[model samples]
Target: MIHRLQNISELIEVSSRMGSDINLIQATGGNTSIKIDGYMIVKASGKHLANAFSENIFVETNPQDYYYNKNGDIKIINPKKSSIREGDLKPSIECNFHALLPKKIILHSHPIEIMAHTMLNSFHSKADLALKGMNWKYINYAKPGEALAMEIAKSMKVDNNIYILANHGLIVCADTVKEAERLQSNVINKLKLNRRVLKDCELESLENIVESIPDAYLPNNKIIHTLGSDEWSLELARKSAYSPDHAVFCGIYPLIIKDINQDWKRLMQGHTYAIIEGKGVILFENSGKYLEDMLLAQAEVFARIPVEESVTTLSINQCKDLVNWEAEKYRKKMLEKLVK
Candidate 1:
């Protein structure tokens, strides 16, 4: 037990660093795991990587413990034999591939640098030149969890250690924690791009939009206002491009208010966020930091994308699949309890 927790501690150290870097991960969006003596300890569903050090946010499981049905739902082989920890916590939905992978250490992250390219329509044509000579394969978009794990498993080769998950993020696998960290840093440095600078946000317009929204909704911060003041970013916010966390936390699309004078709240369209065009951004009432980070993450990803690159968005079906997923709902519920 002590040895396992020791391994978990190392993973937490790696995860804590990853969580603190907004450009790498935000809120409880990413997960980490380490395989030890045939047992794997992975981040719990919807738990914050940043809080792993301070909380019991990992679960012990084996690849053989769970299986996917024809309907693609994950099922435990013997629920009665499952760990007591699993009574309230479970491995991340992404743990399927982690357990099945050949590597001993895995770090899955939503890197802004990598996501910038995955969102690009032209990334496939440009990948060879961008990551030439690297052991990386770009996995096409798939619904998260079992489906995504299988997609990656099919594409993986003996030498491929890094995977660029299209419309998703980056995955780096290694045999040791230090080696994993080193590889991740190399990938980030290699793929990182300079963000397109935005002009200063119009404060008066931002204030006006803030006043128009119900008092319950407030701007997360003055920084997110740049998302609305810029025409291109405002357009990007509407779709948020199917990154699983954004869809799960912030909803499929944001409510766009072209004119604040219109009945804005009624037009929310069930979205938790309202991007007031020409003004700034506002969160729905009772918004949590998870949603806040994802909102800013949406803005960050869209801003880094070049204007000419046609962005790929998740299909309506894809968004529906992620938003309505039972596992995600559990994660959201867990996130609130663990992170706070």
Candidate 2:
């Protein structure tokens, strides 16, 4: 275990750097892990990657013994079984996948570019052309945690090193930390696609509407801008959420304000932002950076979607499933805790 101890700093540094990139991970949406000997070190639950290196945000575990409880939920295996350090923080819900994979390092990210492709109905086939140089496994959307790990195990191939979780994100595994970083870079470079840029006029128009709303719902100091004034973005906002991340962070669908006469109180009850027809989007008071990032991500996903292809958005039922899941509830609670 001496070798593992020597590499702990590297693992923390890499994970912290990855978290610092808003394009790769926003808030506490991603996780990283390292396995050495009989122990596995994983990002603690609800902990931001940006804090990985600065704080004791990692938990060590014995991966060999894990199982489900009577309620069919996976127990938090060896949550307190640690040799490196101790804390009250919980391990990431994704620790199951990290433990299952035999690689020395595992990095999972909800990169907007990668998720943009995965959110589409044609990701499995389209990704082939986009990432032709590397072998990747595309797994359909599964509930996070054990369910996701099970699907990954079933889909794992002898040659593929990357796994793209549909409507979610990407996972890369490698025998060495340097190789893992290289693979992630390669995937990002290959998945590059053009996106629509909102012009100054479009942004000003949205700001005008936002300023007009005298209600407390719209914040005056915060930035006001449309994700995109393009047809694709507007259309995407009209549908149900495209992924669990969207469903949880944003809302099931954006509330479109066709007329200012609409009941503002009722509309903003559970939602954080609203889209105004022929104007733009307006967020609630003190919406903060996390909500803004999610809106931008939503816009990017829509912009990258092929005009001819019909995207596969989360169904109402599926959206409900995600919102009602205990894991998501805990994550949301933790996010709220962090914000405070």
Candidate 3:
């Protein structure tokens, strides 16, 4: 048992180091865990990785012995302390999934480039293609917590070391923390290399239209002006474009509008801007600007990467798949809002 805890301590150090190195996780956006004996030392909920060195990572009840409630939430019972019960130091909202993974070391994160791809419905096949021959599984999207964990446990095959959480992030597991980190780094590097080419563009034509929109949305209008000319728009319309995932969330095709009024009308009709075409994306009150900001922020992250680094490009068919998925999600969200 003493040796096991020592091993777990080493695993935690490796996990924390990798999390810091990857740029995917900032503050507390990701978590890591190591299984020791019957217990697991998971990154404590809401703790930043930079501060997640040796002492502060919390020690909770053994995950193996945790019980499920009627609602499917795990009821963690800490045997060591009389006061420490199920609800103390709320387990990670994703704790159950981490608990169920068969690997001794587990790491999960929402890397901007990866998240941009995963959030789009079109990229599933692309990811499958990229990861072909690798030991992995892709799980459909599910709400976080016990339900997700249950699904992962059931869907994951014993031979797979990685699980791509649809619309979420990636999970890599291995016998050792170093192996898992290597796998993650390799995947990220491959994705970067695959997306290096810039889709052809000619931005001289949309100068007038770009002038009218609010400045808040046009952080880099000079680039937009250079890339979104009428001729550029027409040409881009004929060809598929590149973006890590904007094509998936907003749609594969740019909604070319000659005027702000037309742009408003299209948005009112429910359309999003494509990254390649520089058509501004629209957000509805029901869907909220938060989700829109997330998408744009993801795009900005990709934009910062050098053009030579992004090798993969989304196909036209993949773009259509994302449009259909986002449309369905929007419909469901609108329906729920109406109900409320």
Ranking by lDDT: 1, 2, 3
Between candidates 2 and 3, which one is better according to lDDT?
Answer: 2
Off by over 4 Å in 1: 66-87, 262-269, 338-340
lDDT values of the candidates?
A: 0.76, 0.73, 0.53
What is the RMSD, in Å, between candidate 3 and the native fold over all Cα?
Answer: 9.8
What is candidate 1's TM-score against the reference? 0.90
For TM-score, the strongest prediction is: 1
Candidate 1 residues 1-340, lDDT tens each?
4568775667889999998889888877888888888888888887778877787778888755544434334342432244335557777888777775668899999998788778888777777777888899989998878788778767767688998898888889999899999988888788777788864477775666666667436564566776787777776776744587777877777777776676645655456667777777777665666777777777778778776667888887888898888888888887677556
- Per lDDT, the best of the predicted structures is 1
Candidate 3, residues 71-117: lDDT per residue as tens digits? 44435333223222333344454666667677888888766566546
What's the TM-score of every candidate structure?
Answer: 0.90, 0.86, 0.54
- For candidate 2, write residues 1-340 as lDDT tens digits: 3455456887888888999887788777889988887788888777888887667768776665433334333343442343244356677888877877768889999887888877667766767888887878888888777778878877666477898888888899998888998899889778766665532226565655666664424323222333434555677678898877778787787777667666666765666777776556677764644787677667666767766667878789888888887777787777787778
Total backbone collisions, model 1: 0
Model 3 ranges with Cα > 4 A deviation: 1-7, 66-88, 193-297, 300-340
lDDT-wise, the better of 1 and 3 is 1
* Candidate order by decreasing TM-score: 1, 2, 3
Provide the global lDDT of candidate 3 against the true structure. 0.53
